[model samples]
Target: MDQEKPKSSALSEKSGVEQPEIVSKIAAGHIVALRNKNVAAADLISGILSGNITALSRAITLVESTNPEHLAKANEVINGCLPHANQSIRIGITGVPGVGKSTFIEAFGKHLTGIGKKVAVLAVDPSSTISHGSILGDKTRMEELVKDQNAFIRPSPSGETLGGVARKTRETITLCEAFGFDTIVIETVGVGQSETAVHSMVDFFLLLKISGAGDELQGIKRGIMEMADAIVINKADGDNIKKARLAKTEFNRALHLFPAKKSGWTPKVSTCSAITKDGIDEVWEMISEFLELTKSNHYFGEKRREQNQYWMLETIDERLKNHFYNDKNTIALLEQNKKAVQNNEISPFAAAQILLENYFKFNH
Candidate 1:
């Protein structure tokens, strides 16, 4: 699994000049510090490659950075670790705000662990600021799993995008698998009950819903319903038991409206009480059955291989966009061109064209 090592950290030294690594190190004082500011990240990346949990978390931080140099190294580290990746069941789970996504994950992850599966959770909520990392103390909420030796829970806010994924989530997924985690569960910041980007990259997409009778249907937009491979009426216990049952009936009726899934598994609408843990195994069985069905029919491997190609293109797009935006000259030109266009000195189209032209020229 040897990759041509990422051409040294030389690409990151600013000054608009690529200096020798020694010159950069001499100018910066510390060679080690010059690469990863998060000492934890280097250690963590090593752990991830070797299957260590603490190091895996640190590596995820490096991947999630808004900073440039860290991001470059993050890329190198994860790529070096990728041959060991893609071994897990990448499942994206989303639902409306009150759908108990965290609780269900805790239970589901426990079930995976009970059967000798290693599970990792990346709760994607992008609204979270640097000051606050994850949405809530789900680590506290899923206290049992948090402490489990076989489980690793990472709570990250879904970045300010509707894609239902946070920054660098793809890298985190890779890191999880490289560490020998076979089941990777990504929980998104449930957006109006629709599944989007996060689900697009996964092997199975699960949409959790609270059985709200007619009201529940209204909350879950039609688009999300269309994307669901499986829909579950969560919190199916106590007084809500009847409502959950009815919700399944309604969903089954509605699922019939859509075309058949590529995976060829009929989307099942089941009930589960994360609180009581009843039907937990049923949910697990449904997932296993779906996986077996897809894997047997060839969709499982084919879909994931397609996802890999998608990710390759996605990474190129993201990196190219970031490179252009981060080029200081590009930023300066963009601002100046924006004012010129606003003042009527230049047409908006010409101004944008200039930005695009200069971007390629400068980057080239």
Candidate 2:
């Protein structure tokens, strides 16, 4: 009888009444507020000018978007931000995959912020050929910098081509500058055409290398080395210190072989251990010297003017290319010609010419 009494449940039976909404009203209100948030150009411009990181990030996303409407709004935001931009130092850093570009940038960025400078790092991650997607893992790699209040780190996919990626990055730099970041660092995807793209946008170009990573001079690309304002030998601590100094000497000699840069400043080569934070200050001092020389000689402003002109022409070219490719008729013709060329029924050049003519005619 006691066992039977114990079997009776103390819990209440289920009610037939319907339950209230699972989400709390406060949370629902917050979500609705975010959804209905005003992202107008004027509001974004105001927020960006006041150093609102969220606004700056949203504006950058708008710039990177492919939507025509978003692009128009992005242009408006850029135009508004232009008056406040060009007041910051834009630095570009490039290196091979294993040269520790992310680590170097994180260390350098933290140093800049420590000196009371607001720093922004724009890291470009290479897109996969098959998936056309990027890992965008720079934020994860730069753990400390990402947590720094004075630092901002943004990693973007290196789109279909370096040109597209560079364009977006340049715009992002303007937004960051307008947001009061005095130091803007653009890290390229790798040591290739991306170096040139980044070089054209930044005031200072830095090339990072490591010692004993094969001959210091063997895999070096001439164009990249020429564009470099400074060659930094990273990973220079531990057993790598001596080798790094020797590599620096080799790079210094190699740098001398190239004609003097038009800026009239010799490219400096130095070694640093990103892990140990050794010689990082010298890197910034070197950059400061370059700035003093360039600014005093008026080359800094002149170079910026030239870059503006170059980007203007590039924008025109990109717009025309997009116009041609996005045309419905051109897309159709392109598909047909692609198949024809594959079948050897038509030469690639001829097919390209036919597509171009069709595009022009249709546009006219």
Off by over 4 Å in 1: 1-46, 128-136, 192-194, 213-216, 337-350
**Candidate 1 C-alpha lDDT tens digits along 210-250:** 87645755844568877778888889999999888988888
Relative to the true structure, how large is the alpha-carbon lDDT of every model? 0.80, 0.88
TM-score of 1: 0.81
| Each candidate structure's count of clashing pairs | 7, 0
List all candidate RMSDs to the true structure.
Answer: 14.6, 6.3
**Residue-wise C-alpha lDDT for candidate 2, range 1-364, written one tens digit per residue:** 5555555465644569666789999999998898578679999999999988888988998898877768789999999999999899999888888999999999999999999999999988888889988899999999999999999999988878763254588789889999999999988888467877888899999989889988666746688888989989999998989999999888887877888889999999999989999989999999999999999999999999999999998889988988888888888889899999999999999999899888888788
Best candidate, TM-score:
2
Estimate the TM-score of every prediction: 0.81, 0.90
Q: What pairs collide in candidate 1?
A: 44-55, 124-158, 125-157, 125-158, 126-157, 126-158, 126-159
- Candidate 2, superposed: residue stretches over 4 Å from native: 1-38, 163-166
Index of the highest-lDDT prediction? 2
Worst 10 residues of 2 by lDDT: 1-10
Error of 2 at 27 (Å): 5.0
